[model samples]
Target: MSIALAAISILHLLDLVILITSTAANAWIVDGDLSADLWYKCTSKNGGYHCKQSINEDWLQAVQALMVLAVLFCLLSFVFFLCQLFTLVKGGRFYFTAVFQILASLFVMSGAIIFTVMNYAAASSSYGYAYVLAWLAFPLTLGSGLIYIILRKTE
Candidate 1:
């Protein structure tokens, strides 16, 4: 593959890795002895730790759904990129892949924003690595999408 395509592939892969890791981790917020994620809230109790299902808030559910959608869209975009790379004409652009990736970026951004806004009113806790990673993935996904849109198929 050409260097440009390889570079774009690597970037897309990196964004996907970040998205998956952030979504699955249990560290969106960390308090003194408690941590919360999309799925669960864990607390240190009696020298041990206990986990419970996250509160059933509509916004929280939306954030969870959006994050999952972002991961799926990113994965679909990668698959589309591979297929287009093999079959697309030399001058054709990866519009399909670009659209999917752009949507992925938007979904991730929306999820993160909602989480940040909703959590601001909750008990005091600092954002954790997973939260930071979700924000980090947004720009990477956006850049990858723009690259796809600008890139042309090459020999």
Candidate 2:
């Protein structure tokens, strides 16, 4: 039981880390020497790199907000899990934590889907690390949330 609990906690932490990194890293699209992310587009100029605000689009803004919300909800879920772990009686389910985590997963999925459908500028460029990471975090978070939903406190 202890080992399983520790593993779940670790997976949750990993999902949180991936969510943060994916949302913040500037690599959503990669072109020859240019890259773009949620917040900025960076291009390599003669011996240097220049970064500017990302394209102003409604969908892009929606993706940005969703990613941020996902990260926040994920963090909150973990905190709730810790609090519940100590306060809940044996056999109590971590429903609050599971809900938050599941919502986080949904937010991530929504953001990624929006990007996939709306990102026109990047049609020529290849998807970058941040894009891949966002997709990766989605399943991990969902799995963690499902694990929490089915898990019960045990001595």
All models, RMSD in angstroms: 1.4, 0.9
Cα lDDT, all candidates? 0.94, 0.96
TM-score of each: 0.95, 0.97
Give the number of the best model, judged by TM-score: 2
For residues 3-88, what per-residue lDDT tens digits would candidate 1 score against the true structure? 77778889999999999999999999998888989999999989998999999999999999999999999999999999998899
Stretches of candidate 2 exceeding 4 Å from the true structure? none
Name the weakest run of 10 consecutive residues (lDDT summed) in model 2: 116-125
Against the true structure, candidate 2 has what lDDT?
A: 0.96
Task: Give one clash count per candidate, in the order shown.
Answer: 0, 0
